[model samples]
Target: MIGLVMAGGKGTRMDAKEEKLLLQYKKPVVIHVIDALKSSNCFSKIMAATSDNSPNTQSLLQNNGIETIKTKGDGYVSDLNAALSYLHELTLVVSGDLPLLDGGIIKDLVASYDGGAWQSFLVTKKFLDDMNMMLEFSVNHDNKECYYTGISIVDPKKISSTNTIKETYRIIDDKRLALNLNTKRDYDLLKGA
Candidate 1:
């Protein structure tokens, strides 16, 4: 599995230098996510897709020997699809903003995946408490039901079918997926709430 981290936004919502991916917890947000993936031994390759054309993000990946993909926010699926283009195997795509996630949870997602039979699979879970409140997503059903954890396990070939990569998720569950840092409020909430 290839670990994909999406941390490229211009930090528009926060309007601060704190791009959600770079936001801090005990450490930078993206680092935590990357470390988790690395620790899982679930992915053979680790990639980060970002809108930042600067060398900062790429440098980080380069130092770690991970692949980097640049994307556009003009469309959700389009950006994701473009990033998926560089990968050819099963992949784990996650947001760079999930600071509190445990590497173990990612392993669980890898273990729970059914491969979608080339269809795609996502980690699914429910919203029941404050921790659940940290996550944001609506549960949906279509011959199935799940509140898509932003974190997903998918066949790159299947996702590559679409030309869009932004907001590519269609269905899933997993509350731990939502604690992304989008604003100072989001960061503060994460630090304490």
Candidate 2:
């Protein structure tokens, strides 16, 4: 298995001068995500997908001895496609702004993967409600409403154009997956938690 952390976003919603992935929590948000992926022991290799706009982010990852893949910074789907094109076999993709992410959640997602689906995500609705995180879209799976946790497993070889290839969902009640740092309000809530 290969792991890729998506850290190329400009984070306009964060309203910060620096990249959101560089924002300090217990540590840099990107570092927290990288640590989680490393601790999960689920990947043979772990790399970060970055873009030209985020030189600092790329430098930080490299300074920490992490490898990075440079993308166009065009958009999430486009960047994802660029990164996917280079990887083969099962690839685990995670958002870099999830400070609350940890090994257990990643482990669970990896273990639940059946290897039959083109793409799979770990999702939750109750956890989002409990954390007061709002998603513009809601998904219904297994008769339950849920939101994506920003963690997914995909067969990179199966990806032709976009990340939205045939997909599957794994509903989980894990609250750790709900704390996505998108805004100042979210950062405040995360700090409080």
Give TM-scores for every candidate, taking all chains together and pairing residue i with residue i.
0.77, 0.92
- Looking at model 2, residue 46 earns an lDDT score of 93
The clash count of every prediction, one per candidate, is 22, 0
lDDT of 2 by residue, 54-169 (tens): 88999999999888999999977789878888898799888898898899988988898877435446456666677677644567888878777677888877766563577877
For model 2, what is the alpha-carbon lDDT of residue 129?
74
RMSD of 2: 1.8
Deviation (Å) of 190 in candidate 2? 0.9
Name the lDDT value of residue 9 in candidate 1.
58
lDDT of 1 by residue, 56-117 (tens): 65566667777788887544356676787788898887877777677787877778776562
C-alpha displacement of 192 in model 2, angstroms? Answer: 0.7
Give the residue spans of candidate 1 off by over 4 A.
53-55, 73-76, 117-129, 132-137, 142-147, 163-175
Q: TM-score of the candidate numbered 1?
A: 0.77
